[model samples]
Target: MKHYIYLFTLVCIMMSCKKPYNPPVTTTNYNYLVIEGLINTGQDSTIYKLSRTVPIGSAIANSPESGATVTIENDKSNVYALKEIRKGIYAAGLNLDTTHKYRLRVKTTDGKEYLSDFVQAKDSPTIDSVQYEYTGNAENIYSYTHDPKNNTRYYRWEYQETYLYYSPVPSYYIFKNNSIVPTNADDETQVCYISDTSSTILLNSTAKLVQDVIYKNPITVVPITLDKLKVRYSILVKQYALTADAYNYYQNLKKDTENLGSIFDAQPSAAATNIHCISNPGVPVLGYIAAGSVSQERIFIDRSDFYAASVGVDYSYCGGAVITYKATQRTPYPDIITIGTDIPTDSLVAAPILGSKDSLFTIQYATAACVDCTLKGSNKKPAFWK
Candidate 1:
């Protein structure tokens, strides 16, 4: 009887210690407006990207909020209208007074209105230098800047990177008129340029420091194994001044979106936005707008900057195969070198035969992605490229 009692007690303890607890399924059926971008007070054109945020289970994050009337309003009642250059993207050139405060006014296609809080245009200090440090397996790019007035304490950064790329096997020929032909010297698919924009949220604050100085604030890191470091690389860094409120909002957003999924991490929370829906005050908006003048700087890094051991000689899976010319009793001198029709699909590289003599003998072939730089990037160099 005592054994039975002990067994029952143990069973009860085991039942109470269930491993998984599933909360009830909650659905957010309403889409919320998400406004992004800064109002540039300088000579540069100002652009705002508007979109709608979907549910947590949504496969797509950005549902563009189209057909919206966007405007910039100042304290003196001066209004500047922005035209929709593209779907969900509104742009305008504004030369507003630096002393006056500015705010954004937006009216959605659904007839709902929204407004951003009035903010003073903060001036971004010039970036003193953008330097890099080599660490274990990666290179960290850092930015240095300071505000002489010590008033601009908060900062934000965005960057665009362009890199030169080369095809593993240079394509010197083109298939035309049912024959292999040599391409123009300049038309060879040997080199190209590719560019990418920064998507991560980068922010810094010097509010607690004695002087408004940001020294060696790391912006981004490039792993040594990344293809971006395979050749000449250039980065254009744009810095923005932000208010304390804007800084905190971005910080919260970074934590909510980028810092999740860790076991010890806190649960994701809603990020606060300055823009609000006037029609339905209870509806959540998903962005913060700050008025500021941006400062930009560009730097280039060559392959020589990389450590010898870190350089990647084989960035792509590139190899060549030879397809021999075959003549049979049934078919005399069949065209086995013609890509997409005669050559085995696996052996066709879209490029012409590796050499003119190969057309008479066995044809040397490769993959287009491995031999054609145009498949990855443009052969025309960017105007800013040096």
Candidate 2:
């Protein structure tokens, strides 16, 4: 009888297990509305990307918005119609207006309309003058300084430089009163033509304007022609608080360890340190200082010929670790041979060394900065000294 009872209990447990368990029902509803391709500023014609949201836990199998009319209109009468450049990439053909706010409106083929909240494009700050200083050291480093007066600001620069080159050609020199200066007429009367026409010269060179671009953003846009050369670059620079904690964090970074470790390595050198390595190399080590906090700030330039020859991968940004190099080419100036002690300005201009516009020396810009460090007590130590 006990065996029969155990069999019945087992049958009852099996029956309970046969009933299927149900999962909790989720009530989350998803909508298809996403805004992309938002530019930093609205001053120029920028693309405003729109897309539908993929359902959660759903596989995306060739999901594309077949037919959609996307329009971006500002409070003003600036209506921008978007063209489908590629799949899901709707380009708005209107330049940004700083004066008015803008909104994105989308209409689907199924009579469903979607609208986005008005978002103002951030304004770009004014760009100050760009100054380049060349170095005489063998490393051929150039230092560029962008001295923007504004302190509380974040900015990036895109350099578009037009390099000019001219070749020599012979032509007749017609003098005043329709008198032609004969060729090989005299040492001073020979007719020669200085070529003034300039053509775009493509530099066949590669430079590492940025290295280990894990930190610096890479540009994805198709190489756009600025002037007459292909261009590439993408960078992100933000403003951070200048504080001890922030400085400490940077100091502890592997890239910044060398400079930080040198803080406590200060010692009196037998000679003066070459503070201006660009101008004076192998100068003496004036003194050394202890490590202290330093605020690091920088800007990112693009990867172009303007950067390839002069800037290196580690020196692309305006701040941080920098190694400079010299220009590979030198300028040629003409020297004049004359009898007079004082050469006339008119005659001097005809000589190669005197009238040459090109400089034998060119500077290559690299990124580097000085951090505050502690120094040893000196014989003329002031009250601030311990």
Candidate 3:
């Protein structure tokens, strides 16, 4: 017993001696410029995102690199300027000729110049389809595409998903000017649309196959519990063609930026980039500029396909919250507190009101966010929504 007790005491001392090591990577502020996105040779707009690498333990999730001048230049010296669509996001479609090689040039606000190696434009095959299969618990989405010429061997995909969902209960009336007003069709706050984009790097290769065909490339998985699958949902899959070298860059990038949950996980290192900082050659830039025409396909899934599997978002809290009790809400004064902002969700008529008259009743109200679908998402439907 004494030996076991001694061993336990020693183990505790050894465990207490363990300390966390904050590596130089975390302590150092190495904000390297990260250039992302493609240079489209098609009618679709070419978008590029510029951001700086944030050190570990940053409160902000992203650090966008703004005020940078980005442009695409051809071997013939034709330069097409890109406009900043948003902070750190630059986009513009180029009248690109497939015969000519292209490159990107960037001038940061700091007056530093970066240029990418000239790359030939890649032609992407049209996406055959975007399909989804629902297993009671989840929905698995896939992308299908093929290049008959066998010229396009490498591939990458991105997706944008939009869905229609509704509030737990439909609000028939709206609170306006401290009065309950009957809601019109335009003012209905029951259904709404929400959108999300792909965050993961999706890639596939058919280099060694007899035909350059991709089958059921896993795009994303949707949990039925999310509001996403509550009603009608649509996914637009965008496919890009990648060269052999560009494919390697994306693969390395996916590894360096992800899967760091523990100290034993792979530490991030600079991924190879075609972009070179001419001002300071020693400085590291992360990204490769690929010139390609995008292929797209969209598919919609209605709840009827798998309605029984969905449990949807629970908004019962919006109903159980009783802000106050009232009597004769018609008075709209001191008998009951005036609903300054929202419509009363429920009203009791000819029921005894607490601390008020017997003939009067109670009105239960909830915050606008709880009852108004527009608060969470746009009530105005998308043009393509069916």
Q: What is the C-alpha RMSD of each candidate to the true structure, in Å?
A: 6.3, 28.7, 4.8
| Candidate 3 local lDDT, 1-386, one digit each (tens) | 99999999999999999998855655577888889888888888889999988877788779998999999999999999999989999998775788889999999988789999999999799999888988778889998888889999999999999999787756666666666666788887788898889999998999989999999899999988888888888998999999999998888888876766776878877667899999999988888989979998888988788756336777666763444334343464332235544555655334565675544544566667676777778888899888
Task: List model 1 lDDT by residue over 1-386, tens digit each.
Answer: 99999999999999999798676655775788888888888889889999987777777867898999999999999999999999999998887778989999999989899998899989899999998887867778999999999999999999998889877776575454665455676655678898899988999999999999999988889876777778888899999999888899999999988898777987888877888888889878888888878999999988787674765456455666666452331122235444513222232223335544223334566665676676677889899999
Assess candidate 1 and give its TM-score to the true structure. 0.80
Tens-digit per-residue lDDT, 162-254, candidate 2: 211111112222122222222233322211111111121111101232321112222112122321122222222221211222223233331
In model 1, what is the error at residue 128, expressed in angstroms? 0.9
Extract clashing residue pairs from model 1: none
Q: How close is candidate 2 to the true structure, as a TM-score?
A: 0.28
Candidate 1 segments exceeding 4 Å error: 1-29, 54-62, 173-188, 324-362
lDDT of each: 0.80, 0.32, 0.82
Ten contiguous residues with the weakest lDDT in model 2 = 368-377
Ranking by lDDT: 3, 1, 2
Candidate 3 local lDDT, residue 326: 44
Candidates, ranked, TM-score: 3, 1, 2
